[model samples]
Target: MPTLRRTHPADLPPVQRRELWAWAGYDFANSGYTTVVITAVFNAYFVRVVADGADWATFAWTLALSLSYLLVAVTAPALGAWADLRARKKFLLAITTAVCVAGTAALAACGPGSVALAIALVVVTNAAFGTGENVIAAFLPELASEDGMGRLSGYGWGFGYVGGLLILGVCLWWIMAGAAAFGVDASAVVPQTMLITAAAFLLAALPTLLVLRERARPQPARSGLWRTSFARLRQALLESEGLIDLRRFLLCIVCYQAGVMTVITIAAIFTEQALGFSTTESIVLIMVVNVTAAVGALVFGLVQDRLGHRPTLAITLVAWLAAIGLFWFAEDRRLVWVAANVAGLALGASQSAGRALVGYLCPARREAEVFGLWGLAVKLSSVIGPLAFGAVSWASGGDYRIAMLATSLFFVAGLAILATVDVPRGRAAARVADAAIG
Candidate 1:
């Protein structure tokens, strides 16, 4: 018999590389929807135009965000467990992606004075997007080894920011020139922009469906989705004596992610309402942030491998605290631009590091189930952070600066918890778990 040859690390097969790109492509595809629909264009448009310029616009927008996340928080873990047990991550991802694309397209019909329709669409689309995020993340450990996981996760995040920038640029150009260049009426600009967003998401996501393959084996049948999910979750939390570090690390993510998500959800509105930025200026600022964020994700992702996930995350959280401080003190509109870039760096690094850490810590057999819990932590933050920001804004009579500063406490709290996590211990535990399962 002929001797088999071992492939070296530097000589990974082209097939593997292609699959990696396809995985990253999903991030690129969905980011367009996030940047234009959720983060930048439509969010502002909904508050300014669709809501008829209500005094409570900021509160209402944050409330809607909270509700959408609440839905995700309640369902993500059960769905994740079900997908894992059934070997259906790719199938479910497709269904959720379709929901996001369709709901985004329907926003074209939500003209001004369609606040109810706009809210409904945002809620549905956001929930779908959040679910897709969790499912897509479940593929991370399968795509790259732990040694290179940081780089791969970072690449995905970097690609996502690039996609966000490209889509935001397209929408900005349309808004600036649509009336004269495309014969679009000013009244129809926002609605038409929603159509553009939907198209971008649908087109960009095609590669993921074509190229990405599921690697999970179907687990034994369980009594029910919720029962299996809860049992597995409980096992990971309580029965596994070695997962204490994992448990602590997840709690840390919940605290810091609250600050991170609040900043992302509110950045556009804060700039528009407090600093008086025009629609074009706000989009441009976000574009600049995206450029820096892509750079940050790539740079910090490499750094994460060398410095280790815990140290890298702690540094990112400090950056977050400083950025929030700048937002609180920024009076000149230009100063807000500076803060935006700082926040962008922290945003990319923290997210990339967090995902890599979880990929490192989770057992291979439990990728979907564990990442589902990760999604749960993130969704829970979405609910708490936005609600807290909205409440502060409402209580302060819409003093968004105070509300923004309040987010710092979450970063500080998370960092305190992160300092205690033993990275090597957690990783060893995960390996042991994987061995037992194997």
Candidate 2:
């Protein structure tokens, strides 16, 4: 276990200082999965290479993700609860990351014929990666003061977008032109791609291990961790009338996140299958989206800090609706490129602001528990979103346009729900929760 080094609450004034950067460093670490593995490269590789000929591979992959997220939803709150009680955030984060990194690294054993093994590894990797994100979420309050949460969240999002973009660029170049540079045959490049990606995941984790300080002492016994976590989550959610606001937030997140996840998870498939782009072209398109997302994170982080989280998130919801509408009418690969960039912008804006808003709404003391619930919101949407996209596409005679159109409703409904919920009310309630807990 890493040593717990205490940071005084008085020392958190600089919104973008070293502590915050160390916090955001985790984003840079995890975005490799989102960019290179999930969005751009590995997903495409799976559908095109590993999962080919099993007409069921795409559906199976989606199902695997859905199952993984379902597990996350069930387990995250308890994990958060356990971490809080035990002061074991670092331990949990390290363990979960190791699972993900190991799974990602083991992808080297997957070849054209190892579909079952590939699926197992991906499932392990995805589950651990998703769960680890929740553990990382618990570390945020230690890194930033209350007032700085929005900008800090935005910075994390921005950093993640940039990191993912940079890594994806390298992976793409390696495929397109780096084979000769590395003295490797073009045929062996894909596995090498996985190897590089795996290395990135491990290296990215090192900063968090080295820099972020957790001052809390672990509970001696690790027994009943999951059960205790669930019990505490229930208590957190139902402990007081104050939780009603969090309920509203969770509901809104579910609807909007479903749309966001659908669009992002299905992007490469939409590009290649619908727009008739080749693998390399699809990857380049995904890269363009990520770059634009980095820009959007920067712009919106400032906007969120200025105009407030709800309005910024609402604007993102509107942008998401527009992006989906664009995709529905998308005629050529060019339009897909346009939609990808637009969606990227909205994706970054919403994620950055949404997380910040949750931080703002939850009391600092209860942050870990609340973040666990937030993780539940995130993972549950993972189940509904991608599965919905896949199911819609499957049912619509393979037309992805319907799936795109369907996502617009999610955005609109979520926006409406958010409009009714008062951000100030949530904040006030959270303060009460904090005082009571304190």
Judged by lDDT, which candidate is best? 1
lDDT of 2: 0.78
My TM-score estimates for the predictions, one after another, are 0.94, 0.92
Q: Least accurate stretch of 10 residues (summed lDDT) in model 1? A: 1-10
Q: How does model 1 score by TM-score?
A: 0.94
Candidate 1: how large is its RMSD? 3.7
lDDT of 2 by residue, 201-313 (tens): 78987987777777554544445766666766777667656767777888899999998888778777877788788777877787778778877877897777678778999
lDDT of each: 0.85, 0.78
In Å, residue 400's CA in model 2 sits off its true spot by 0.5
Encode model 1's per-residue lDDT on 91-121: one tens digit a residue: 9999999999999999999877888888898
For model 1, the stretches where C-alpha displacement exceeds 4 angstroms are 1-15, 182-187, 222-226, 238-240
Q: Residue 317 of candidate 2: its Cα lDDT?
A: 92
